[model samples]
Target: MAEKRDYYEVLGVGKDASDDDIKKSYRKLARQYHPDVNKAADAEQKFKEVKEAYDVLSDNQKRATYDRYGHVDPNQGFGGGGGGAGDFGGFGDIFDMFFGGGGGRRDPNAPQRGNDLQYTMTIEFKEAVFGKETDIQIPRTETCDTCSGSGAKPGTKPETCTICHGSGQQEVVQNTPFGRIVNRRACTNCSGTGKVIKEKCGTCHGAGKVKKQRKIHVRIPAGVDEGAQIRLSGEGESGVRGGPAGDLYIVIRVKSHEFFERDGDDIYCEVPLTFAQAALGDEIEIPTLTEKVKLKIPAGTQTGTYFRLKGKGVPRLRGYGQGDQHVKVTVVTPTKLSDEQKELLRQFSGTEGEATPQEHHETIFEKMKKAFRGE
Candidate 1:
């Protein structure tokens, strides 16, 4: 496989580009390389690349992830700042040694954001196409009401830690050949919380939070494809020390439709037509996303020919208008035939090329009808 280009580079936009700027660039490129409009051999591939880039950049969450971690390989999962996790860890270690910066020495009482949560939801194909509003229950940690997030009993309060003077970190000095090195570690006396609750809160057992189930209502929009995520703001675990709550991500898994196959917003399916119908042409009912509509098959239609139904596919995820539905027709040949039918076919074979295909088709239909009536 070839290496992929940067998404921003693919869309020809800067990292700080606005959402409208990204969408505008995508629309321009989509029209420029549309396979139906551009006849170049690589037009389809270019269109796919543009679509992929837009899919990532147009999504705020995905774009932020890309910005933080450049080019995360989908098959290999997310990598760190550089190389494997060990290399990233080693780099962090070197930085911490030079500058007094590490998580071990951080202020424990500082406000910290809660951890984000993820839930996988499987929905029906029609539900994904049409959208839905539903409720889900998930277990998460929440701040204790009784303790007021302080881990203290009802009438009591927490006291500052005696060790480390409420800094929550213990420091040590070592004399080296180059200079004296100062190392810091979390103070074990207060468990790095910078406060001690002599009488622990019975509700939370000295912790400032409690585990509970939360009900969240989610709205899945129309045209959501597989693996697409919906972000719910501040619906994750409760924050620590008055910090902001994290977000909850709902990942969608759309079940496969029995007949319809989707590619982007386009719908594709195949319909079978009998020999007479293919040769003589007919108006047949084709199923769209919403309803069944009549599709005209021109006379002398060949197998594998596709007819497009405009505005019959899925709605665009971001903007107005609907995609197209592509219907391919395959001709089915008869396997079992009556003796009279065989004779008629033989006669037609003897006179092959003597009449137009339409005439032959009409002749076969009439003969078959008469045979059915025992004429």
Candidate 2:
């Protein structure tokens, strides 16, 4: 009936309207036909149609396809008998643009979210290992307190842009090889805001934002390693036009520990021991992230032997309890010996066994030597 009015006309906009115009008009119509806003019997159907129109018109490629092929089948916008309408940018993009959540332009009339801010924080090894909560002061652009990000002076309000007529864009026709090609671009005078500030806010100089230094406490989670990023939501620079503030990203840098090395969930340390302890066995106290734990050195322990003290390492990042601390033993040789020690070693050498067959620990030569010796 009535040939199902053209989508562009259904939204009451020119065929040559810019993308912003199509979006603005679609938003207005969608809000008007929303079931909650309008109790009309055909509100749902009309809302779907408006959404369909916006979906096709919002994308440059889809709009071009539709412009060339109309509503005819095989038109790229058809989409398996009209099923591909909602697969464009998703409903979130549409909602974010209109509601001021996706970094879009703020309506000189709505509450906006704050802008996201980033800060680099360097922490000591102990603080990152044990966790610390500290406050940092940062200077950023925040919402103006005087005008509340309105960019208007005193009690005045921002007026709609007359050049783009609240569409934030304008069209210009250009001569091309393929006839005339019409293109839309943001208005240069008003910067595509569709509104110009006649009287500016005295506090912010009509920018609707102010620079201020604010202190915010950041919590460093235990087991956070170097280059770890911590996100503090809703703690960034203030938004404009009454928008909410953005998020804060804290990048962590952990200083190296002198005695310990970290490998993921494992804590490693090299413990040095005298040759006497490595040969005769001894209990040595080792340092860990927590308390000092005593480790036993077995007799004949090699220099590279690793001993593990369970649950004595740094805490796991995303799993269970702490990790095991690995202690790598390093044997120290005696550089200077006393005269009594040399005499005692000479006496011990005199009690050594008589001449015997040479034994090879790693080959069949040991068995052959035993056979030649006749036991």
Candidate 3:
């Protein structure tokens, strides 16, 4: 017979390689040499070799025994039976690789937490700017009052599972070419709860919960933006058996405002100004999140100029202070003019050495080009 290769060498890992490293190396080799992917004549044998190496290296106890004795002895406490390394079949190793290795059993009667629930709420724009408290109704599972959440009929209790003896797990032993392999998994008979209800509750029909509509009071904080989420603990579905209840998440959706636009904590709005106001400054009333505020537009202010109103924007959701409001000015020109208004504008244009709008535009464009060229 051909001599067996070193397990670490077969997996291309060091003798002292970490468990994660060993697993990674084994997975890489297994994928490369798998028969379905690689049609090489020796691919199956190479795949088997990789699986064997992983199975032994992944198990602390088996790896320790192999390291000390140079090989595993099946008759000993660690090994399944007296067998050579080549005895390992490919199928059993593949099963172990996919399903996972052995581990301690779990108690089936343990309580499990309930599932969480989510609710999306739409609120007015002003309501998001300022905090509000509201009530909402939601349908969720509540503990069954009829049987006191035991899932058993009145005056009766759940009986321990006979298959797993209330341990909630079962031990499975399989004889492979590598020897006898042992694994512990959840009990099938009791469904891993290690308890069974023979006389089920009539109201819940063996389920420890019942569906009902519940009213919840939620407080939305000031300055909460769209897509914000609030968590309410112990407000979700009731737990299975006697477990603890889960939480409820409230997602907030703020409606759009007609005039105000919000960015972070800052608020912005556009205000139209007459041509005279742009040339000569004036105090104007602008809309803010809470109320209308007065803003001073400086003399000779151009279109698209911004005026700041400190502490007139949205409140900070987390910090102590509020944000400022910015007002963008848009100068409006008269579209229709009276004969007297036109004559005054013509005289004003004559003094400025521009007689027509076309001449004024060309002169300004020429000056802009010269300025840009540093003339």
Candidate 4:
């Protein structure tokens, strides 16, 4: 690769320029060289160069390192800054300031990656449990079949820009404390593209791309939770001038289930039991992620007791095996009893010890009294 261009010279602003001045100048140049309006051959290279320049001068730490070492390669960690990790943070602000908002206007000659697309998918509860395959249709940009993304008419090629002489840049010299500083700005006449298209492509109108509907297939892995994102590389919008395509992200939304609630990979459900069943131990069937399982309730089983069924919940999202499902007990009392049943219960209650009744009723009263006292 050729030696990289100087950071100060790339943005066309002076080395001592303030942050606001650099930003303002970059925005102006970006608009001027933007591929949509300017059809120069070197427009894309100029855009990347400006972006790289802003990537460095905007940050305090990176800018300090560059100022001290006079354009030390930050990627090499020569002066003080760390490797590429430091480089991206500086650019992250730039991306947010520009592309982070609503989409910018489209340019035909610009070498831009296709626009990213998002699709919302609703998965059935059962499918969320076991995972499933699905297909979707997305409307996006594709390389123009007729012009092949060149945006120029067939049999015609772009000519060298008369203004910039193919360098796509113009340099201006200014006096500074260090010495005379030379700055690089995108050639105003060529709009940064060293070349200009004489006869535009008829099909794409020199856009080099076209809009079309495409079908994409996605496989959802098992145990995907709500709001999970799946990325489809190179499936987004088409790029201009043979640029790489953008990515497609699928966001999943899980529908609510009638009987179950999820806690991470674990499934929970409440099982109801009649008084008779609670008094006399019985084997009851409960629902699991895969199938039904049997749970045995011991005699005199109390309400709210939880039972764990190992490996019966959802599959682990990050690890192997499945989570344990919990079954909570809720004892049901009869609202109305038959005359004979009422008499039998009264007789049984009479035989029951007074101490048992006092223990239950007194405990509740004490709690109520404490609550009344604002305990």
Candidate 5:
């Protein structure tokens, strides 16, 4: 097998591209490489590549994993196939786009998946740098225990709808000038359920589900940035009529650190240095994500100079290796000085061919007098 291309490269998008940008790029590529439309020999292969790339990039968790790991296994999360062209009504929409209308209507009576839920979770900066497990309380719909999602009273089953004969649909014919038009819509009597509950479930009021507070434990991956999302499959609301449950999305918000800031996987912090330390090289301890490490500041190092400490930053979320920590040097100036200290600094300035503090003050006074006298 050939080595796969990078997902971002395949979709012609940057690694930091937004979700909408990725979607637009994938759609354009998919339309161009669609086998039925392109008719080229390699169109099918290109289409598959586009689909696979979109499948990984469009999902937050998969994209994060792929970004850190370089490649993702097909069986990990891409196996079920829920994104890209397949998600846009599959080939039916493609055929409709080229050949014109024939898209089928979804069956209203079919078991519908539960609605996905979103929750914003705030964590400490350190917790985001190093992964942590925590629990959250969320209110979601759960299947009622009394009726077991049947929506009927205990010991009593739902009856077939009399209006549509339990088909969950009704057909109507209209006489028009063009011809007789036949149409099918959901059965009004049973609301497309094909059944009617004579006695509603006492616990859920015939809805077959009830809202309750649930405590869900979430394992947050390391190196998660602000606005990063963690997906919990089948942890959302319970489905209707025994359908599959939806997903729960945990949106992460990392609190700001007093000394450190994060950029992607890297950590950044500013370290203060004295003028003497900048002029004469000195070894100082700097704070990393985990601990303090010794950093050597070279002689004559200027303010705003950045020093990189490799493998001392946040760990990759799911891949090997760690990001580097950048320390920015900020030279501090003394606000007050003793007479002896000032005299030593003046003597040092005389050797360097610069004016002493008293000589500089006299020069400035003479300039002000000359300017005042227009000389």
Candidate 6:
């Protein structure tokens, strides 16, 4: 005894075959196995198998029945009616079914919000810290006054679309072997607006909007950093169909300073110190954000000494009180030497006392002391 082949295998398709897939496979197998085209002994048998598979799979009810109960007898079951094998005229037909008309459609006459706009503003470092208020001119669209936001003329009015019956859309239907399908698309007569203007406004040329410059006042707050955004309400482009206007966003760009580097709210800077002032105690003047302040240097101060000045940095953006300023001192080496100065330095070195550097700068100091003692 021989086993029966699956219907999906006969049509060369998966178990979940679509109508188009079954139709295509049936056409190809029918042309290949027909007695007029093929002379093989099994050609007639193969053609019958392909026809039976397509007839069962192409119908939704029959396919569901076959899936629920496997290998149902076609002669005694529901949806058993089959088309003749020579029904080639209906090969290119397609059908789609849609329920609840106008459920997913958008009305052309509905109000819509305007688009938001963005602008970049560059300011100096001091300006960002102190903040300022200024006015700016921006060109944007505005509603026309001639037709009062309508695209029609002053006396005449807009007419409803005749093609789509003022619905702004049209339905397309296609007939297939199983049933019919309907597709909804935008209408072409009135450009989906559902309204046609025979006579256009003179000022806006039927657009219902005009291009004009608007002056807006902006106030920048203190302690604003780079990439900060300030929003202005109702300052964007005009909306269509009497909708509300959008917002305007202003992005900030802070300029760099030549003498100072900022890290968050803290300020960092390097100051130069003379060799005499670093070795011996001295009080020097240092520049702060506001005024010059006096900073004391210890007698044994080495290079790269850091000093902090309270309440001298930039103001905090989100809290109370100001940040501190960090100052780093770099000792300047003397490039030129006088003859008398060199002799005095040599005599001082020959009779110098045993004074070592700080622990952090004690590199090679102990070795030099051992070499001097000959130990």
**In candidate 4, residue 61 scores what lDDT?**
75
Which segments of model 4 are wrong by more than 4 Å? Answer: 1-115, 169-191, 348-375
Residue 38 local lDDT, model 1: 81
What lDDT does model 2 reach? Answer: 0.71
- Could you tell me the lDDT of residue 83 within candidate 6? 59
Error of 6 at 199 (Å): 1.6
Per-residue error (Å), model 5, residue 197: 0.9
Q: Which residue segments of model 6 deviate by more than 4 Å?
A: 1-102, 176-179, 346-375
Q: Write the per-residue lDDT of candidate 3 for residues 24-112, one digit (tens) a residue.
A: 78777876886656899999789777777777787788788778875546632432323444444333464455335443334456677
Query: Which consecutive 10 residues in model 3 have the weakest lDDT in total?
Result: 350-359
- Kindly provide the TM-score of model 5 when superposed on the true structure, using C-alpha atoms: 0.63
TM-score of each model, in listed order:
0.65, 0.61, 0.70, 0.58, 0.63, 0.68
Deviating ranges (above 4 Å) for candidate 3: 1-47, 50-103, 349-375
Local lDDT at 30 for model 5: 77
Report the CA-based lDDT of candidate 5 relative to the real structure.
Answer: 0.76
Q: What's the count of clashing pairs in each model shown?
A: 0, 10, 2, 11, 0, 1
Q: List candidate 1 segments past 4 Å from native.
A: 1-105, 173-181, 349-375
TM-score of 6: 0.68
What's the ranking of the predictions by lDDT, best on top? Answer: 1, 5, 3, 6, 2, 4
Q: What's the CA RMSD of model 4 in angstroms? A: 17.2
Better of 5 and 6 by TM-score: 6
Deviation in Å, model 4, residue 134 alpha carbon: 1.2
Residue clash pairs of candidate 3: 74-81, 108-193
What is candidate 6's lDDT per residue for 215-242, written digit by digit as tens? 9999998778899999998998878889
What lDDT score is found at residue 372 in candidate 1? Answer: 34
TM-score of 4: 0.58
Best by TM-score: 3
* Candidate 5: residue 149 lDDT (0-100): 90
